[model samples]
Target: MDLTGKVAIVTGSGRGLGLAYARELAAAGAKVVVNDVDAATAEAAAKEITDAGGTAVAEVAAVGRTEAAEALVARAVDEFGRLDVLVTNAGVLRDKVLWKMSDDDFDTVIDVHLRGTFTCARAAVRRMREQGEGGRLILIGSPAGQRGNFGQTNYSAAKAGIVGFARTWAMELERANITVNAVIPVAATAMTETIPALKPYVDALRAGEPMPPFARTALAFGTPEDAAGLVAFLASDAASGVTGQAIGIGGDRLSLWSHPQQVVAAYADGGWRPGAIAEAWPTTVGAQLQTVGENLPEPPAA
Candidate 1:
């Protein structure tokens, strides 16, 4: 994806997955906007890119803030002339069961993951339309949203919203030649580190519990660079035909078909109902009992 003169903005690029995306894009020749809430960290990340022989500038602003989003867009335009890609990678994890989770916890997670994505994309899309050149928008989602995890109600809800946002926005932006999509990443990031309570699940996998066929596949995990590769392709012109889709990236397992299959099987006899679902529990339990080696991947070391 030779992005020679293109401009790309990656939020939360100060470190971790966002940093990997920025570096990879820069290596592919895009001038980058490294945005983070912490000014010092953002600037340092920019310097890292610059030192590595890539054109980059840092923007310190909270992405959930509309004003900050505008400022971020302005900085990108000022530094690189025009924007070509926007990766809404900034997010936070406020894990708690629905009952125990404080209202503030839920609000904060939503504000950053969903609202921050909205703020940045809203500003970038306008600029993209004005530039008369199509652009790419990639929203980062998570596996927890696809398959609910315990104590992550807030995070899961926000992540799920990104999928819907991409689907709807893809239609609205198609006429403008801009493609919108979501990437569901399950890499061992800071957020995944909090899942230590899943040790039992891990042990069950190792001990060969009755698990779904997909369970065995879940044992594998991907690295940040592994995820960056997909994001790079999505942001490139090569992915022009792909829109309103969600791609999952993990070690050796893309999981592109599993969701569709599950949805189809779920509706085999028309749609779902509470009674039908309840009736299926026994069958579901039986299936799980036959499965093996299904374990959540260990979180990356903090």
Candidate 2:
């Protein structure tokens, strides 16, 4: 899709998935503001895009903070004249079991992943509304949030909260022609490296060796570039009709996730009582309750 004359701000674009998104958007003809906490990495990413004949500027600011988030959107407007796309991809991982997780760990994750998206979207949408041109708000989500992972209580909660933001904002912004969507990407970034089960595949990729079929599938699905195309598409005009949706992208796979809904309903003449609920629970909604772990089938051997 052509994004000529458009401007975009991508948080945490110094490396990995954010960088990929920034680069791809730039390649598609958008001026990009690359935001990251690290000055050097942000500058390097912006320079790389410029070197490749694309327009980009680096903004070294940590997201989640109100001032920082506002600054990022302002930078895009100040440099490029208008803000058209906002990609909230900045995140940090502080993994621990629910009981073992510290207050700082929980707060920090939520601040970066959830609050960062909220603040940035708020800042960008204001500009989009003032400019009287529709815009895109693309928030990053995770597989862990969709299907809970072990020892990621804080991370999972933060990622899951982002979906709620997208859904609500889509409704509020639709009248203005703005679209809000969440992307759950499986990419082989530093974040995915934390998973012990994926180490062998990551190692094989790094060493440039041929991997077994299963490992190859896993590695391909985790490639950062594989997710970038979807972000670029969402930023374009073609996706104007797509909003309030959680889209998944991994390698050759693209899927739409189902929204939360009631699976079964049981009603009484007046209201459900504790005793009545107890009697109907097993055969009603309770019957479909999934087992948390071990009951699921294992992956094929490599």
Say which candidate scores most in lDDT.
Answer: 2
lDDT of 1 by residue, 199-302 (tens): 44444534666433343355545456657888888889899998999888754566551333332233436866888778876666334543222245544455
- TM-score list, all predictions: 0.81, 0.94
- The digit string of per-residue lDDT tens for model 2 on 1-302 reads 89999899999999999999999999999999998899999999999999999999999997889999889988888898999999999999998898998999999999999888889999999999999989999999987878788999988888889998989999999999999999999766788878876666567667886445554354335567879999999999889899999999976678897888877787889999999999999998788876442122245855
Q: Can you list the residue pairs that collide in candidate 1?
A: 210-291, 211-291, 211-292
lDDT of 2: 0.88
Positional deviation of 206 in candidate 1, in angstroms? 22
